[model samples]
Target: MLDPLRLAVGTLTALPVSPPGRIDRRVAGRAMLLAPIAVVPLAVVAGVVLWAGHALGLPSLAVAGVAVGAVALGSRGLHLDGLADTADGLGASYDRERALDIMRRGDSGPTGVATLVLVLIVQCGAMAVAGPATGAAAVLAGRCVLSLCCARGVPSARPEGLGATVAGSVRIPLAVLVFLLAAGLSCLLPGLPWWRGPVAVAVAYAAAGLLLWRCTRRLGGITGDVLGACVETATAAALLALA
Candidate 1:
């Protein structure tokens, strides 16, 4: 468990967690179960950054930007990079091979740049208007979607990579449990309008479902990049629900 926890924290964030000498798919798979636990502190750090910016007499928009920067710094912008790559992959060509090649190029295309800009703008606007509670809920909701993307029977886009290692790592029951816990947490976010949490969570799930179907068909399976895109897309969906 410690190895997996370390893997989860280390792989997902810039946090220093000494990884094992050898990492196998099983370790990566089991780590997905504990991914949310690692995300707890990440979300708290972002929330505190937002709070601090507000306390320092910053405007809501500025505070939202700072909070976004804080989370990106903490996580080393890996998810954001994933979002960019996924968009580039999906947009470069409808053909799976060409799209995957573009993603592997690791350079942002017009579509990737445009998608990232839109996502960031939307996220910042939502956080500015909705405040910290909504941010917290969105974080929780975003982490929950990872469980769905990595659940049993989900195929990996690459034969050997993070996607292959973690995909199908989680059992159906555990995946369902984690996702439900996230949805319930969304419904219980403190200081939020009662309607905000449920609506956000529901919309997040719907958005994820759509992504899963589309990506599976187009990419032939989910990839690490797709999961990253899912986090951002679903986070925006959840936050927009609050808005």
Candidate 2:
């Protein structure tokens, strides 16, 4: 059996996968099953930092902002990259293929930059108001929803890239299992009302689903960057709604 941690790390990070192990259908499906496992530590660390900041007399807003930035760094700015690429692709008046070409380019355009700023601003503002537990939950929920997007929409798009490679390989049941696990983890937050966490997760998933549908309609599927974008956008939306 493949180590779940290895698959999770390989999938979540841009770190080099030694030997570039073959990701078959079962492996891809299993990878989705493991994605949420990665989120558990991330959520825990963010929550601890937020709580520690409050306990240490640090301004909640400052702490929240730093916490957000820290989490972003841990993910290696993967979602930010996605958010920018998706914005560029969506804003481009060129054909979908050309827009995708623009997105694939390593440069960020005005629209992309603006979208990134807007997302961070909203996320920070929400975190400041909602306090740490809710904010952390929102972030975790958003990550889970993004994983769902990879398991569902991206795979079906059959695009000629990462989306295609991973999507068709995973099974739906395993994907759902991962989402449930992530949701369960979100509920573990102390002082966070039980119902609220699940409700927040549902909202995040709904928003992500709609956004993914729109992106698929426009571009016929999602890219790795688009997946990252979905996570950030959904997380922001969830935080705003919770706030």
Candidate 3:
């Protein structure tokens, strides 16, 4: 069995994993199982940093902004790249295949840049308005929802993309269990209402479902970048709704 902790950390961080050991199919499958488990600490660290900055009379907004950006770097540009790629893909006026092709390219077009800027601006503003506790809850809940997509949704426009490697490998029940546990933890955080966590989770899932449906119609499946965009979009939406 793969070490759940290593799998979780490896998935969350951009660290290089030794080939064969890290890229083993079994390890990838197990990573899907462990990714949600990894999100909790990332959320906690973000929350604590923002909360501490607030309590210390630092500009909470600035502190939270920097903290969010800092954590994003640690994730090795995963979701942000997703955001950019998805934007380019969706914004393209070409056919679906051509759009997907555009996304596969490493270059970012105007749409991708705009989408990234917009998402960051909205997230930063929402976090500033909602304060640390609520922002943390929203972010954590959003990530849990994203992890569910990776665990459950069909991946990729092809049979061999990153999405396909892990698609449907995650047990549905395990995803639910992790989500519930994360929601409970979010509620336990000071100053956050229990209802807020569930509500945010619900919203995030609903939004993800809509995106999944749309993607399916357009590309016949979800790509890793699509999953990233879903999380980023859902997180921003949840935070904005709470704010």
My TM-score estimates for the predictions, one after another, are 0.93, 0.86, 0.85
Q: After superposition, how far is residue 110 of candidate 1 from its true place, in Å?
A: 0.2
Evaluation by TM-score, superior candidate among 1 and 2: 1
Candidate 3's residue-wise lDDT over 100-164, tens digit each? 88888968999999999998888887777666667767766666665566565555665777767
- Candidate 2 Cα deviation (angstroms), residue 217: 0.5
- Model 1, TM vs. native: 0.93
Best by TM-score: 1
What would the per-residue lDDT of candidate 2 be over residues 1-243, giving only the tens digit for each residue?
Answer: 355446666667544444336566566556655665556666666777887888898887888788788778777888888889888988985477887788889689999999999889988877776766777777677767645676643544434666665564555676677567756765775666766666677778887888788778877777777778888887887787777
Clashing residue pairs in candidate 2 (N, C-alpha, C atoms within 3 angstroms): 155-167
Worst 10 residues of 3 by lDDT: 16-25
Best model number under lDDT: 1
Lowest-sum lDDT 10-residue window in model 1 = 179-188
Report the candidate with higher lDDT, 2 versus 3.
2
Per-residue lDDT of model 1, residues 32-130, tens digit only = 777778777778876887777777878888888887777778778888888999988888789999988888787898899999999999988988876
- Superposition-based RMSD of candidate 2 using all C-alpha atoms, in angstroms: 2.7
